[model samples]
Target: MSLVELIAQADERGLAAAGVSCLDRCVPLLGGDDEVLRPLWASLAEDGDGWGERVAKIRGHACDAATGAGAEAVSGPRSGPGAEAEAALLARRMLAAVPAERSAGALREWADTCSVAALDIHRLLDVADDGNTSVTDCREGRTEGMPPLVTAELRRQVTVLELLAGHGAAGVRQALEVSAEGRRVLQAVVSRRARGRT
Candidate 1:
């Protein structure tokens, strides 16, 4: 099913998972450890009821990580200090994209916005781009300028949301696997960007 159709059919839990998974996978953009959002994923997987609390905690952690507060220092090097600020802004957008109520409307909004936001984060860190083509072009019709890794991440985000929307709770595992794949792709992107700085 298409992403719109699947989202229309998803239940509350499925919708929530769709949004959470997207944000969870994008954690690396904030220079956060990969496991930072694991608790939120665990909550969804086990049907635990503390989603709000988890979201709050994650927001705090994102803030700390952005400011280099109590959070762990990201191990690899950075593209530059400005890259962190751009990444942090994108991470904040992901967090804010989520809504308080676990309704289909909220999830749809979050899912759509988060998908674009995640791509924007990748574009911000894509230092290789020489401005001949923009991410906006990729969304339009020009995919040649976009990196394969970023393309894969965008595809995964859409797939996860579509799966949840189509299959609801029954599709959670598959959706998560898709999200995990995206996370791995973004991790590689992050690593490459860091290495290029050296």
Candidate 2:
């Protein structure tokens, strides 16, 4: 199903998880630890109020990490010039994208924005640099190419929304699992970049 159609049918819980999952996948861009967003996921799983607090904590951590002063030191150090500042800026945008309250409209907006932002952040962090270039080019009537990694991410995002639309609350667990898979993919990408730096 199309993202708009899926979002139009999602309930509040599905919408909330959709937004959180997007941020969760892009945590590495913030220089955040792998588990930093775990509590937010837990809150969604339990349908509790703790997600707000967890988001706050993550925002602070992301800010510090981007400045090279994280409480939990980042690995290998960001060697690219201005990369830290760029990561921090993207992190801020991610946090801001979270809806202030639970509503399908709000969550849909957040999810849509995150989809584009996460792709941009990944492109910025990718060693290859060509991964998302064609996506932009395609939009500009210049090229039809999209890197496989980016294509997979976009597919996963659409699938999550579709699952939520199809099964409502019952689909939450499956959606979370899909989000986790995306996170693992991004984590592997981060690790690969780290290894290449040495």
Candidate 3:
């Protein structure tokens, strides 16, 4: 099934996982560490307890990190030229927009939004043009000529949703693993960009 179809049929947990997975992969752009989003992943593994509190805590941390107040924050290429800064802004916006309510409807919307934002972030940072103007089109399955970064991101997003749908709560760990891999890739891209600028 297409990602849109998978998201439309997903349960509340699936939607939350999808959204969180997107944000988790983009953490590098927000100057977050590899494990910065672990609390959110752990919340997905258990019953829906303290989910709101975890999100709130992460939001506070993300805000502080963006402003260079958080100790865990690592300065990266996101502070560089136009595309890098824009990508960082999009990543921060994804965290800031997390909804307090974990309802299926709200999560579905957030998941859709995060998917687009994550794609946009990749497109901005990608060395090659993805050849598409609208990320909405890519999400809707029109992905010919996609750049490596965007293609990998789209694949990861779909994998995360499929894992959650097929395994229910059992999939959160695997989804998190997928996200971690993507985070490492983005971190390398950020590092490479930083080195190139020096």
Give lDDT per model, in order. 0.65, 0.64, 0.84
Candidate 1: tens digits of C-alpha lDDT, residues 75-178: 43334646555665666777766675555687777866765666667666666645354555554435775765456655665577667556756677887788
Q: Where is model 1 more than 4 Å wrong at Cα?
A: 1-11, 46-48, 69-84, 127-146
Output the number of the TM-score-best candidate.
Answer: 3
Model 1 lDDT vs. the true structure?
0.65
Q: 2 or 3, which is superior by lDDT?
A: 3
Q: What is the lDDT of candidate 3?
A: 0.84
Q: Over 4 Å off in model 2, which ranges? A: 48-51, 69-88, 125-144
Model 2 agreement with the true structure over 31-138: per-residue lDDT tens digits: 767677676667666766765677677667766765552223234434453443454466567776676555568776776667666656655565555533754442
Show pairs that collide, candidate 3.
none
Tell me how far the alpha carbon of residue 122 in candidate 3 is from the true structure, in angstroms, after superposition. Answer: 0.5
Top lDDT prediction, candidate number: 3
Task: List candidate 3 segments past 4 Å from native.
Answer: 68-80, 130-133
Q: Give a tens-digit lDDT track for model 3, residues 73-157.
A: 3344433466777777778878988888788888999999999899988988888873355677778888778888998999999
Total clashing pairs in model 3? 0
